[model samples]
Target: MDNLLSSYSPDFPVASDGTQTFDRDALQERIARVRTALTTRRNPHGAVAILADNSPDWLAVDLATAQLGLTLVPLPLFFTPAQWVHVLAQSGATALFCAQPQQGAALGFSAMTDYGGGLLLCEAPARGGPLPLPGARKITFTSGTTSVPKGVCLTSEQQWEVAHALHRGVSGLGIKRHLCLLPFAVLLENIAGAYTALLSGATMICPPLAETGLQGASGFDPQVCLAAIERYQAQSIILLPQMLQALVAATKPGDARLACLRFVAVGGARTPPRLIELARMHGLPVFEGYGLSECSSVVALNLPGAERIGSVGRVLPHRSVRIAGDGEIEVRGNLGHYLGEAPAPDAWLATGDLGHIDADGFLYIEGRKKDILITGFGRNVSPEWPETALLGTGAVAQAVVVGDGMPFLSALIVPATAAIDAAQIAAAVGLANRDLPDYAQIRRWILVAPFTPANGHATANGRPRRQLIQQHYAQQIASLYDTTEHIA
Candidate 1:
């Protein structure tokens, strides 16, 4: 009956099987043990690299690192072996932890510890207990889908501030349950899904990642996601725009399977209004949110109490936001300093995103500032707007618009189904053109193969890696305008 932050009961139960709950006392003990081990080795300043799937042990390690006052770097689960090496070296992680030693050994780290089957057991140290160093100096490697990935350093205080802001933002809501769909390695999910849920005394239900309605090659099966929702009776969940679209496609009209659900937050990219409408019609309360990694995951979210259809919702209570003269979103209050050095007083984090706020205070995200295309005739265009239009046609699975430094805009599209012919794609393009101006319209397009996470064409959160996609299909994109008839 104790409040979430008040008790700090290390013995509190985390999971249950209808009969009994799994206590977290052992996890706290493991943290004590790890602290002892690190102190005995005189390596408190060293960084610990954790490469493991989501499980009880992962939480244990995270909590343990926090208790020990040691730096923790969570390695992405989907990274290639080469990427793993790059992150390990770039992060300067001295110790590596994994569920599988063989895989850890392959990564070629100096020291490796195998905590088998996602369970770690260690004895508490007598002398070296917890440290008062505030919290972790966490470093998360960027998903270098387009360019080289950089290490984003965040302090524990900063992370905790973000969690607190989210807690304050949603505090009025009653006790809720959160179903985590994205991988824990993703900062958005880690902070918002896990930390915010913890702050709210909410139960965090993590179904298998593959069954969570994610739409990429590495995404979850929509059917499995629905079944998990029914089994757990999840009240709230998170999804990317693509996953929301997929769920809308998979479910029948007026399906009551998700009747228990209250809120389904969709982000990581723009959510089409049509998809939101479909999800609402299918009995899912989908709310679109807007955020980026630099802002500690969430700056604005549409709450159930103050819902809006197309906007990402009002700015959270602790945050201050404004649009710059150049159309960039500038955010200020309740912000944290970057890891390495203190931020300046006027440190207005320029969210490379461009959007406008309406008189009613709802945020309508236009598109990425860098992704905005301007034609040779001097017309501004947001590729995402047109891409969303193309996707709503149902035949196009994905669309990327290219027009920067070009005479006119062109598009590269992927079909929704393997059997979908070129004519169908063209028809979708035609529909998209109807809503666009001549300068912003796609004059030429090519049917490209499916975008996949393995190739780095899409982010782990399912947003298209526009720069990477442009690089991957550079030749094809150029070929689109190679024909004399298509050239302006």
Candidate 2:
């Protein structure tokens, strides 16, 4: 904490929520109060979990826990109730800080005291034993496509190094104000977005998700988000690819309302090259990057002057990227350990992604190595590549491509709205197929319901669970190969 605090000036603003701004001194006071409360209020061994919206107080709790060398777990509001129960029980969290005291109590936490910024500090029943996380300062759970989310254990140094590398990468851009678009529970936004902003001496503007037009897991309104960007004069922001697509459609050519934006980082999913081009055409500077929770946060990012359109940009100085014999993208770096597990035996972490590096050192991601589909004709296909095209049409809301060990590819598509008919979906698929290869094109498809986390068809971040979806719709998928009721 001392080393981290020295990086920030004493009087400069570091955090704000549109109503209050906290300078270094004010922020330090909050951290001290939290530290004092924790030391005097709870057991010394168990972990503490925070369940609240994005606010300055949440940042304070994170800093305080880091200073005390205590384990802190951040819970995502987008998770379902059952997920919350699972995390609390599995992590054995003895304390919680949340906006709603009643909700915390219902989850087996009793109200102890009221922390500032409308957060209630509560305590839970004692666990049977110590937490499984060793030498871990923070435990961030991944919103996996499966039913259960896994916790990634990270030390303070690992997270700080990633933030410092990110600060060094874009220090010349002079991004003074960064708006928090994604939830801070997301490791990408927490480490790369907020931590990097603090290291670079940039003020982080944090607003509630509702205020920024984000609700639940997958709800986003680009118009409301654009209003926040303009209202706060945000010079830099991070977004998911789907959010970027919506912003591109909302902004007109040479839109002056978004003139304040200088750097927009898009990641958390594969971004189509056309979306990046479209965003630039609308006067928004969108840079694509890539990373996962296991590598801390950001591994590579496209800078202002240095960028490759289809690539995720060059690897950062802190990490090294190499391709395996099977063409899997493996990263050699100081990675964190998985919760309740031992350290990795190997030096390089196999990132389950298939990609290659260019001569100039830019990294391009093809798709998930496990999600790749092999056809009967022995042609390898990445569903994400074609799914990106299908989503680009703006008429298809959700799509899952499945054709492993089959003659041709097939898709289960959900239209943007109920007003869209079979003819509209066929036209959209045709438009998407025009750019794809002959073997990769969707020869047959069926209109289906939306895929969501609540339905076990997708992750909290909205990435489809291919295997589970395939198992659930095995009969439907089999019928697609048959000659009956073909829509496309």
Candidate 3:
């Protein structure tokens, strides 16, 4: 069990301060100090809830927790105060690590730290000990069907297997300098952007907030991300589908800023093949991937040399996958424990996703098993398929279809660019309908605002919170069926 920190040398690791480059040796040393504090306190099996934004200190504390064998719960910075309180209490965390003093004080955790108290508080130290190579590790609290959220437990061994698989799959591309666009709190980015980079001996660059494309009123600036790529000379990066779309739209032909880029891995939602083709035509390398929180991030990915259009690529070497009789994707190998429950020794885990393997072993993801829309005529329609086709028209920003109880499917579309009028959307929908069966066609639609994470309609990685969005716009959807509204 070699510790994660011990793998890296004591020599100064590079860090960005927006202007000058700084060494991370002090950060490593701070981590070591934190580990000592935890050991001296002798609180085994205690849970620590980390309430912090992305920063050097956050990484240090994470490494420290690994060294100390303490369960670490990384809380989302975007959560409301009441949501934070609820999660902290439900997690039964014995200590709180606050990046902001106000956060701790507001929750009354600051006083607990002062009074020989229930909660211990300390600034994340810079140095830490070596992390164990591979063993059981805990990551909890995943977004679930209910508001309470669910905790997913993954062992270090499971994470290592995934990292190794990804490293092998993308080996043909040579070494890569990965720009981490997704938040580190996400398991997908944490393992893929951090662990996988470490496994591949690649440079893992974390851009400053200003350089991360998350600026201005719209929240993320695609231009800043492109500029950072040029500045850092980054060869690879991870993006959600929405971010990828924005980058594609923002980029122009002959943009030398992307000349050095080797691959842009897009996941967290279904990606349209037309979008991928558009990116490739513009000299961008966008590879699509698929996975879930239970799989330690990526289960399948399209790599540089081995890519299949309209597919999520072949399964990684470290895992085994099979399509059930009903088209559900069931997986096994490198399996881990479920949070709040004991680990299962079975060889298979139901992925709850529906997809089929192509003749060449590529995976074509149809949609979520839970989200299949059944028409009144008994035809099965996966909204993702139609949605992908709709997005291909380049006019629709977001589309969600509902037809579970209705005779005909209906869509709620978010038009791209304010200038694009309803006529443009109708034309796109008409084009999409030309290729779909009569039962699968969108009989009607309602224009709406784009779903976003800030508004709770999307996940951190940009996946649609389908049920939430449906609930929020239930009235609008109902109005689409009104007699006054007409559908061509």
Clashes of each: 1, 0, 25
Instruction: Give every collision pair in model 2.
Output: none
lDDT of 1 at 446: 86
lDDT at position 261, candidate 2: 90
Using all chains and alpha carbons, the TM-scores for the candidates as numbered come to 0.86, 0.94, 0.88
For 164-281, candidate 1 gives per-residue lDDT tens digits of: 8777766776546777777777887888877787787676666446555554336556787888777778777788776676677678777777887877888888887777887898
**Which residues of candidate 3, in runs, are more than 4 Å off?**
1-27, 41-45, 111-136, 208-210, 215-218, 345-347
Candidate 1 TM-score versus the reference: 0.86
Show model 2 residue runs off by greater than 4 Å.
3-11, 416-424, 484-486
Q: State the C-alpha lDDT per candidate.
A: 0.70, 0.85, 0.72
Between prediction 1 and prediction 3, the one with superior TM-score is 3
- Model 2: residue 226 alpha-carbon error in angstroms: 1.0
- Model 2: lDDT equals 0.85
Model 1 misplacement above 4 A:
1-13, 16-21, 24-42, 110-136, 144-147, 171-175, 211-217, 334-342, 405-407, 484-488
Ranking by TM-score: 2, 3, 1
What is the alpha-carbon lDDT of model 3 when measured against the actual structure? 0.72
